[model samples]
Target: MRATLIEVAPRDGFQPIAPFIPTNEKVAFVEAAHAAGLRRIEIGSFVNPKAVPQLRDTAEVLRRTAGLEGLDAQVLVPNARGVALALEAGARHIAYVVSASEAHNRSNVRRDVASSIAEYGEIVSGLPAGVRLRLNLATSFDCPFDGRMAEGLVLSRLEALLAHHEDVEVGLCDTTGRADPDHVFSLASACLARFGEWTRWVFHGHDTYGLGLANVAAAWRAGITAFDAAFGGLGGCPFAPGATGNVATEDVAWMFARMGVNTGVDLDALVRLAARAASLPGAAPGGRVRAALLGACATT
Candidate 1:
C-alpha cells in the first residue's frame, strides 16, 4: 500500500521561529521540496502579521511557488479574511485551522469553537470555483490547556465541521504532542469508522513525547493514508505551551520505506533539505533520522 506525505516545514515548521526567513528563502525551500519528490506542501499561512510575523510574506511565497509543476502548494488560513488574502494571492488550496478544545481555540484564534465552526461554514459557502478546502482540527487528540480530548467530543466537533461541507479534507491534529499511541489509534479508528465516507482524513502529529512516529504508525494502521510532517521536525504551536516540532518528514519517509509502503519520497535528498532546515537561524529543529543518516554517511 502507498501513503501520501505532505511537507509542512515551510509553514508549520517556520511559523514558530522568531526570526524572519526571507521570502526568497521560503520560496526556494518550497521549490527544493518539489524537486525532492514532495507533491503537496503547506508553504505558508495568511494570518495577522502582528501575531505571526514569521509568515508575513506568505502571499509572496505563494505567488513565487505557484508555478512549480505538479506541486500542490497549500497555505494555512485562520478565518474568512485569511481565505480572502490567500485567494487574492493565487492560492487554490487553503487549510483553515480551528482547535477542538475550547480553551485552546480561544488561545490560538481568539474565538470559541462554535465561532470558528460558523466561520468555516461561511468560508465554504463563499469559496470560488477551482478552490479546495482543508480543515485542520487542531487539538483533536490532546490540548495543552484542556488535556486529552474525549473521543466523543472530537467526534461531535468533526461532525459539526463536516456538516458544513463534506467535500473538504480534514486533518486530526495533535497540537500539543501529548497523545499516546493507543489514544491516537482509538480516536483515529473511531473517526475513520464513523466519517470515512464524508471526507478524506489526514493525521498531523508532533514528536515532543517521542511517540510521533508511533502515533503516525497507529493512524496508518487505522487506515489514514495522508499525513503532515515537517522537515527536521521543525514546528510548534505558539499557543500550545510545551508543544514541540512535528514528526520529521525524513523519519516518516524512512519508516514507510522500510515497511515497503510507497511514499514516493527520496530519503537522501530529503535529508539534505532537512539539514538546511535544521540550520535555520532561531529555528528549533528536531528529529533523529537526519543525524543518524549524517553519521552513517560520515562513517562510510
Candidate 2:
C-alpha cells in the first residue's frame, strides 16, 4: 500500500504552545520536512494573530518557502479574511474547517452549522482559478462537548459541502482522540460508501488516548490514502479540552515502512528532523522510532 502524508507540525503542532518559535526556525523545519520527502505541508493558519500568536508570522513563513521546488504549502483559513491573507501570501492550497458537532463548530469558528456551511459556499464560489480549497470535518468521530458522532451526521455535513463544490478534498479529524479503531473504520467506510471513490479523503487523528496509530491503520484499511500527521506528534486543539498532539509524522512513516508500504519519506532524515522538533520549546516527539534511532546512535 502507498500513501501520501501531509506534514502538519508547523501549523497544528505549534498552535497551542506559549513560547513563540522564531520565523527562521519555522522555515528551517519546513525545509527539513521537504528534505524528508514531504511534498505537501500545512505550514500555518491565517487566523487572527491574537488568537494563535504562534502563527502570526504565517505570511513570512509562507514567503520563505515559496521557492522550494515540488513543495506545496496548505494554510488553514477560518474565514474570508483568512482567505485574503492566504491569497496575498501566494498560497495555492487553502483548507477551511467546520466541526461535525454543531456546538463544536460554533465554538471553534464562532458560527453555527448553517452559517458555517454558508461561509464555505462563499469561499469556494469566490476562490480564484488554480487554487484548491479543502474542507476539514473536525470532530468527525466524536466531540468533546457532544460525545460520539454518528457516521450519518458526518456524511450529511459532507453532502452540504459537496452541494456547493464538486470533487472537493475533505479531511476527517478525530479531534479529541475519542475514536477507537472500530469507530474509525466504520466511519471511514460509511463516508466512502456514500461519497464514492472520487472524493479525496484525508484522515487526521490525535494521540490523546494513544490510539492514534491504531486509528490510522483502521482508516487505511477502509481505503483512505491521504493522512495528516504532525512532526513529533505535537498538536492540540485550543477549543477542545484534553485534546493532544496529532499522530507523529515519523511514527506513521515508520509504521508504513515496516509494513512494506511505501510512503516516499526517508526514515533516517525524518528521525533526525523529529529530534530537532523535540528540541523546540513546548514541542515533544512521541514517535518511538525517533527515540530508538537516537538511542542507537548514542550507544555507538
Candidate 3:
C-alpha cells in the first residue's frame, strides 16, 4: 500500500523549544526533509510572533522554501489574517487547527466551539485558488483537559466541520498521544461513515505513550492513507501541555518500508536530520526504532 507522510519536523516539532532555531536551520530541515523523499511539509505557522516565538521567522522560512521544486510548502494559519500572510509568503497550502475539546480549543484560539467553527468558515472563505486547506481536528483521539472523549463526540464534531466545507482535508489528531490501534480503526471507520469518500482524512498521531506506530497501522488498515508524521519525532501541541512530539518520519519510514508499504521517505536521511533537530537547544530526539536501527544499537 502507498501512504503519504507529511513531515511536520520543521514546523510542529520545532515550535515549542528554547534558544529559538535560526531561519537557516529551519531551511536546512526542510531541505533535508525533501532529500528524504518528503514532498509535503508544514514548514511554519503565521500566528503572532509573541504567541509562538518559535515560528517568528515563518515568512522568511516559507520564502526560502517557495522555490524548491517538487516540494509542497504548507503553513498553519490561525485565522484569515494569517492565511493572507501565508499566501503572500508563497505557501501554496494552509492548515487551520480546531480541537474537539472546547477547553483545549478555547485555550489555543480563545474561541468556543461555535465561534471556532465560524472562524474556520471565515478562513475557508478567504483561501486562494490552488491553495489546499487542511482543517486539523485536534484531540480526535483524546483531549488533555477533558480526557478520553468518546468517538461519537469526535465524529459529530468532524461532521459539523465538514458541513461547513466539503473539499477541505480533515486531520484527525491523536492529541496527547492517547490513541490505541483499536481506537484509531474505530474512529477512522466512523469518520468514513459520516464524511463519505470525497473528504480526505489524515491521521496525526503523537507518541506520548508509545503506541504511535501501531495506531498508524490501524488507521492505514482502516482506509487512512494520508498521515502526518514529524522528522525525528519533533513537536508537541503548545496548548496541550505535556503532550509528546509526533511520530517520527524515520520511524514511520522504517515501519512502512518493511511492510512493503511505500511512504516515499528515506529513513537514513531522516535519521540524520532528526539528529540535527535533537542537537538544537531543548529539542528532544525520539523514535526508538530509528535511534536503535541507525545509531550504535543496530546489529544489522
> lDDT by residue for model 3 over 1-300, one digit each (tens)?
799999887788988886788899889889888887899988989988888998999899988887778988888887677877878777788898888888888888878877878888777776677878899898888888999878888878877888878887889999899889999999998888777666998999999899988899999899899889887788898889889889988888888898999887777777878777777889886777666766564564
**Backbone clash tally (model 3):** 2
lDDT of 2 by residue, 1-300 (tens): 799999999999989888999999999999999999999999999999888999999999999998999999999998888999999889999999989999998888888988888989999889999998898999999999999998888888889988898678899999999899999999998888888566789999999999999999999999998999988888899999989889999989988988988999998998888888888877755656678878999999
Listed per model in order, the count of residue pairs whose N, CA or C atoms clash below 3 Å is 0, 1, 2
State the lDDT of candidate 1 residue by residue for 29-69, as single tens digits.
99889989999999999999999999999888888888889
Which residue pairs in candidate 1 collide?
A: none
Best by lDDT: 1
Tell me model 3's lDDT, rounded to 2 decimals: 0.85
lDDT of each: 0.93, 0.91, 0.85
Candidate 2 lDDT (Cα, whole model)?
0.91
List the pairs of residues colliding in candidate 3. 13-234, 13-235
Model 2 alpha-carbon miss at residue 191, Å: 1.0
Between the candidate structures 1 and 3, which one is better when assessed by lDDT? 1
